[model samples]
Target: MSISSMFSNKTSRRGFIKFCSYIASALALPASLVPKIAAALERKPRLPVIWYSFQSCSGCTESLSRAHAPTLEDLIFNYLSLDFHDVLQAASGEAAEQACEQSMREHHGRYVLVVEGSIPLGAKGAYSVCNGLSSLEQLSKAAKGAAAIVAIGSCASFGGLARAAPDPTGARSVAELMQDGQIMKKPLVNLPGCPPLPVVISATLAHFIVFGKLPELDGENRPLAFYGNTIHARCSRLSFFLHGQFAESFDDEGARKGWCLFKLGCKGPSTHNACASCKWNGGVSFPIDSGHPCIGCSEPGFWDSKGFYQPIRGNVPLHS
Candidate 1:
């Protein structure tokens, strides 16, 4: 019941090559390497993934499972072979442990470890445990043999709400753990958000598949393509932001009229993510578009900030 057990389908070399070709086209890869990429895809084999949760809400999972283009079914069926996710897997108790062990042993040197939520190290990892094992122990064991590690959600990437002042749980990010202890030699990619936009997740995965490696990352290990620009750069209400026409309240005329949310503690300018462009619920609406301020959930330490309702910097004057 190793990590390989999570993979439900087998992709033949020929079929994988064909899929690679499609990815090449999708990412606009040059024609000369299309065949090469196709060949690599066919022979490289599907990466096995192990998703682990910790001391936090499963919003990241919920968001990812409900991704716009590739729903949970498509992700499970097509993208990666998710072997042992406690939340999604039906197996429990010793059965679940056996399944995870089986996949780990089978996949061995190659697998993607996706972690959500922060680990509590203060209480000797007692804050969160699964089947009598501490979250930190599980993460360390799994990360040791993974090909690449993805820290999903702000909780996992930057220790979200759990790391606030007077931190009783001792919540910490995967990066801190990795830096403190040598867990794996593989690369680590951080996708920070209260719950990253579904498209952002899909796009990151797609980039990995297309490029055969982690996407170009920022100083924070965030994908440059997705986190390169601030949300304010592409905000639909930029004009309003510039003019200081902000929504005073949730039901104010400004809000109803689609004005900016900057005055309402909008963190668009300070945060970076593809939310405005990638959107949510199949491009229907994002927080700002839906009349809420940008909470900067994608950035680290957003929850512990001074206030969620205070405008950033608190000095910009209102325009006419």
Candidate 2:
């Protein structure tokens, strides 16, 4: 069925246009492009997708699946033909592998590759294997035929906790693996977070479907529209930060008053992401709003950067 027909039966045309307008605004696209975005969704062929998981926890997948009621993420999933995702698909063993291989064959040079977790290169990649193949081996083969690749979450973007100190597994980010082995010669985008916001993922996919290109990226290959500003800039306690008022302890009076968390180990000053504006759990509240300090999970090397509870001012070593 045509994308428009699928939605038209469910809601008025005005309602669908309003939905598209919200998505366009969320993507930082100009207001004038709302109609274009709606048109693209109606006419564009459903893009094929292949998702691969590797050396870390499956928290990213969980995060993506947490999109709230009247789930827009579910709609996005329907918009694309997700051929292979081990966690979500029912097929297993040889059957699953065959489906992935078949999709790659059918959509060669056109399908989108979404990779979660990091790739382990240690012990000949014996640390993590899929269908008798190492994580890196699977990634290399899948990426060869992909038109675009999205590294979802910190694990896939920067090796995350899997590559933390002592690094036994030799876990590496998708970009690092691609660089080392000289593969995945396609547009690559990184969506980093402990587990990235579901809206960010949905909006990014929408941008790709509408524009037929990757959104603009920052130095770390993260989408600039979402990661352009530091959490501190849009933080609710920015006035406290500017006035030099801070909470010295998690439960102190200053903290109760919602003073800046910088002195209490909030990484908002250094972390760049949409958490401040987009919030989480359907725009309800994010970490800082819930009284916990920002952990800087979106940045590279956040795990080993030291002391999540240590004040960012004097104790933590700041990395760009």
Candidate 3:
């Protein structure tokens, strides 16, 4: 299909520049570099992204699909040549698998491989199989030819909740497998969360397209631009946190009054992400905004090891 088929007529150099201006200003970048950002956005080719599924609920796909102002149509059609995504593609069964194989072959050493779920490494890896091929085998083979691999959710990035508790299928993360140096040799970027913010995905794609490389990453390989500051750094309720006023229960007056949820097991103080600032569902709301505690889903071992509903002592000092 053509680019025009996916994006609105307004998707032009000026519109892209206006977008960069908004994003740069949001990230506190200098206005003088707006033209540079625009030029970078204009020149880069829309990357080919091959999205894979394993043992997952497809929440990451769902989250990213909600990108607004420029919806997934814009994302897949304008910014990315999403050659094969199991969830969004029209084909099914053999037809779908073959299409993915063909795209991988056609874009060999050129496409971005986005793994959305964890690989089940138990019972001969039989837990999740597609087209009679084990997910592990398919992933390993796909990784071998990808230019770069992005683990797009907590599942693929850190094994997520599926790997929690007994970990019945021995779920493992993309980084764990890649770290052993036996699979794909491409650089990896992890965007961990139950569902990462859409802008985080957009920014990563933009960085690759503009800079021709991944953004500066944290020790865990997450983009520093999005994950550098704690959620507490940008949370709207931080003022309440500083005053030591916290909600003691989900439906109590404190909560009703929009007091901080730190006392009710919010992990925002230690969680690093742009959830508060970028929000979700088209910048409408986030976990905290919706009256839910920040579960720290982006951090490692968040599912199984996250502490109980109580304020953590000796917590980092609240921002003024």
Q: Pick the candidate with the highest lDDT.
A: 2
C-alpha lDDT score of every prediction, in listed order: 0.78, 0.85, 0.82
TM-score of each: 0.85, 0.94, 0.91
Output the worst ten-in-a-row residue range by lDDT, candidate 3: 1-10
TM-score of 2: 0.94
Off by over 4 Å in 2: 8-12, 68-73, 314-320
RMSD of each: 5.1, 2.6, 2.4
Q: Compared with the true structure, what per-residue lDDT tens digits does model 3 show for residues 1-320?
A: 33343245457655666678865654446788777766765566678889998989999998888876456776666678887888898988888878888988988988889999999989988999987888888899999888899999899999997899899998999999877764666889999988888777776876676666777899989987788889998999999988989898999999999999998888888888989888877788898998988888899988875464656668475541
> Which pairs of residues have clashing backbones in candidate 2?
none
Q: RMSD in angstroms, candidate 3?
A: 2.4
**Top TM-score model:** 2
Error of 3 at 266 (Å): 0.7
Residue 308 alpha-carbon offset, candidate 2, angstroms: 0.7
Worst 10 residues of 2 by lDDT: 311-320
For 140-250, candidate 2 gives per-residue lDDT tens digits of 899999989999999999999898898889989989977776465679999999899987887787789889899999999999889988888899988887788999898
In order of lDDT, best first, we have 2, 3, 1
